[model samples]
Target: MGDTLIDEPTDLSVRLATVFSQMTRVRTFRLMNSAERGPWPALLKAVFTTPSLTCLEIWESPWRRPEEKFTIEALELPQNYSSLQRFVYRVPFSDCFPRESKSYGRRDRVQGSVELSNLRVLASLICDSVEVLELPAELAFLLTHITYPKLRVFSVQGHEPLQLAEWAEILRSARQLREVHLQTPIGFTEWSKTSSNWIESNSIPTAPVPQTHSDDLIMRGLSNLESLTISNPLDPGKELFFQFLPYANLRTFSLKAFPPLSALGARWSGIHSQVLTSSEILCILKGIQLINLSTFEVSYSVDAEDGVMLSHISSSFPSLEKLEIHRYRSLAKYNSEYDPLVSMPDALATATNLQHLMLNLDFPERPYWRDDNLNPERYKVFHGFLESQVASPFTGAIPSLKTLGILCHDAFSSYWDTWEVSKTRKLVSRPPHAMSN
Candidate 1:
């Protein structure tokens, strides 16, 4: 077998077939943008022949469309499509047809039908449209009938508000689903004054439920989920902000944004008007038993007091081992000595189990402060708490604290230099000692 490696047949189909024949435990097949569409028939033949094959991935570039080259008849798969445990099909924006109104308008109608008929064996499905793709209507119907007993993950990406009712139906069917990612615009209609709730409509409403409420519905469906990542934070409907609390099983959550969080929140009346207070944060924390939660992260552009709201989060999550705060800047108005440093360490000090703490601090420049003033007297109280942990006479400050990272903005880099290295060293070297009154 080793000697055959060099002398293997050069013909692509023959080589693929030979490989399939030789590897008995072949479990994965990944097709890149360059995979020839003309050879799909032969590829399917090889796949059916390989009894151990269970996973297949096809990733096409935005610039190329392998599907365009082959007619449906020429690309038929073997009856063994059901043998696969996982299948993924990705088509980048560049690969999609140009946006002609006639073509774009009907694109979903066309592709939805093909997806339903062809990819019936998938236990797991992921589709992405970076530029923009109109998902076909049949795509919804296809999802409704598929029985993925072992299916646990589903993801779809597109710009248009694809049918969400289909998604609700799919979620209702996917008993084993633990994670779902939707990268498309979610569409819902507001009910007339008589209706108690906004209802899912067949057509996009004149004005859809602000992205906030849509996010709520999506979150509600995935209540039993353990992890979720939503790339377009702006698109999550406003009504769904509190939906996360009920997902007690959640261990990890992530959000990426094209538009700022403020703009996203503006779509929802409740979150936009007020900052998250300590009481509200406490309530959210009280709802979930986070003993199993290992990671929590949120990135938003809000006032300093708003950032302080996170301090309330530390005490409630006792089992939290890793924490991350991103895109956070200090509040400007409370730059004086009277303002607190959010006192996050006070709450964190209680989490003897915490091992990693990551804070991304972005403070704006003020005329009264110099570059070397990042950790000025105002931060003294917070720093005092940190110092006590190092010298912690009782439990030894952050006994499990092995790593601490503080990322500062460039504008404040100069402020760090003003600190006397020797004094700072002595401060940290000294073990925790009870302060004398």
Candidate 2:
């Protein structure tokens, strides 16, 4: 028997299938981007037959059309499909043509049906045992028809219109879900009006029956979530984030909010008014206490003024061990008199349990990523400032702190230059090889 590696695209013929079937165990299989679908069915059949397969990753060709269906063709459903614990399908993007648009929905239903059928077959094969599933949001409607009884980690990308009903059904089916990562825009449509009470729309069901009250299911699901991450280029949708709080058993929470277009050389020069104000932060955290939270991260839009919000956060979450205040986009406020190092340590003093902390700041000068011979002097100066002024203060204020990371992004390089704090209160840079972005 010849060794076969299915990492690259191949026209899976009789010889390839024989090679695949003869394999003793296939723990993980990855099919790189392939523009042609001709070889997929044979490859998939061979993969699904492997009872030992635990993870499968497929990236559709970037050149494929958005509506292109991922067909399973005539392949028989594998009895060993339940062995799959992780499945990832990456495509360029997906758009769930909203039912509200009558003309558009009618025209796309034919194209979408092919994708839906393919998904249904895939779901039946693995949804029973998939603990980690990541797919484009357009196919998220699969949750309505299938129950991921063992799903523990669910992630969806792309800004497809997902209704409250769909989200509710997902929560209902994936009862074991512990972590959820949403990298898409989620704005207040109908659910914004009421936090936990959503009335199902009379519009035709996106998927088949087996429905439950979405609002109640959502509330029940959020309470058990241990990690939730939202990275939306548009508004983080304050209401959406807050809805997951107060009742959640969250240990880690991360939110990334993009800076306004004004920051990226747009005509509007004044500071974007969308920055979360101290009052807004207060109202959002008014009756909420994330006592179980050990790790927390947020973008710079989170108020850093006088560090009042930061101070409140530290005080509110007694178990916080790691905290990150980063930026998603370069802010136009680099010229403003707001220096993170000067403002944060004093505020984080109350975080007695915090062990790791990272703060992102604008670089003093633009550095190019392509410049290999970049001057080391700038990094040295920044580290010097952090040790003497920033890390030094943190050592006394947050005695539990063991590391302090300063993140800087330049055109040249972007990474966290971290310092390890010693018992003697000295800050030492962890080796250059240890730095990471």
Candidate 3:
């Protein structure tokens, strides 16, 4: 049946444009192929209807009738979501299309490409105004050609590390970017050179090193960058890791400190047996002078000296509001399974401005989800970890703390979490603006 929007246009392009124009109020759209129906043009039309829509998600089915061919790029999309703020598109990589991966079973549905003919148009339109964007790792390069002047939060999925120079060059214009996250956990590998374990190797051709960033250059360039996260582990002492510190406005920062990787690269390498230490923290803080720094998070293990480190953190950012110390891969091959978190540092007690605190500690009691019996011995361990050792400092360190989050066994015990929270909350005093203030 011919619809009014189509105006009985004989040309397929005109008909599709007609559908897109009529989608005036449609804001949230999901573009995907389903087994019950092949949403040829109707589902795709959902792309343009909403001018005021703020969120859009696009996904493609991995299992489809092998013989069925799906095409997405039917026309040069003419619409743009100038007001769109968040866009999540998990398009299958090119390799996944037209060919089934080893993981796909024999009973798997047909494989085909979501030939969104003009993906560039979609990327261009959203890239302009999107503040928080999560897109396929395959299409992340599209950001290179487009400018996200308003982009504030960005995350890419692919494992490949964006070269330091390329990342810096592209972000040169993203002055408003407060958070830049790279979420490549599995497919990515990082081999960084630390000052302690650096051994210059000549076997691998490493990416060229980026030029050093001076104080003036860093401040003037990415001054607004605050929170940065990367799934790929980092070398704390490496120059690339330090290059991100110019954000005078930095408040929250998280990085996964991975062990030295033996990748195909030529740089100094050393036997790093330590987790991120307080010394590394001080080094970074000293350079950036992040007076407003609030939350500092690191993954992986840590070096000794919890006392001196925590003390510096309190003095460094008196305005600190939140502090988090999570053990990244607390258990690994070379890492021990019985490994426990470091004892609460006494220095933490001095973070007067701290409001929210999260620590990876061994909690008391057992989780209800599992069949394991409650360990009575955990009682001593929990209190000893939180109270006897750093009772005075821990309670006094963050007078402003409203929430104390802890991950025991690097997980949660629904049964005990509620009580632990209540117990800890009462032990710590609240600020004098206490109830009303």
Residue-level lDDT tens digits of model 1 in 1-437 = 11111221337666777778778888777666542231245565565457677666665421122243333344355332346656556531221233432222112323333343344333222221111111222243344444445557766543323345445545555656676554332222331221111112222233344555645555555777776545444343422433443556777654423122222122111211122333434444554466567676545444544434565456666667776554444455534434344344564566667666554434333222222466466455544443453223212334555445433223322111111113123323222211110
Number of the candidate with higher lDDT, 2 or 3? 2
**Candidate 2 residue-wise lDDT at 206:** 55
TM-score of 2: 0.73
- Cα lDDT tens digits, model 3, 282-334, are 55556656677777765434455444556677787777886766443323333
Q: Report the Cα lDDT for residue 364, model 3.
A: 27
Question: Positional deviation of 321 in candidate 1, in angstroms?
Answer: 2.2
- Candidate 1 lDDT score relative to the true structure: 0.43
Evaluation by TM-score, superior candidate among 2 and 3: 2
Q: How close to the true structure is residue 334 of candidate 2, measured as C-alpha lDDT? A: 46
lDDT of each: 0.43, 0.59, 0.46
The per-prediction tally of clashing pairs is 23, 5, 16
Question: Candidates 1 and 2: which is better by TM-score?
Answer: 2
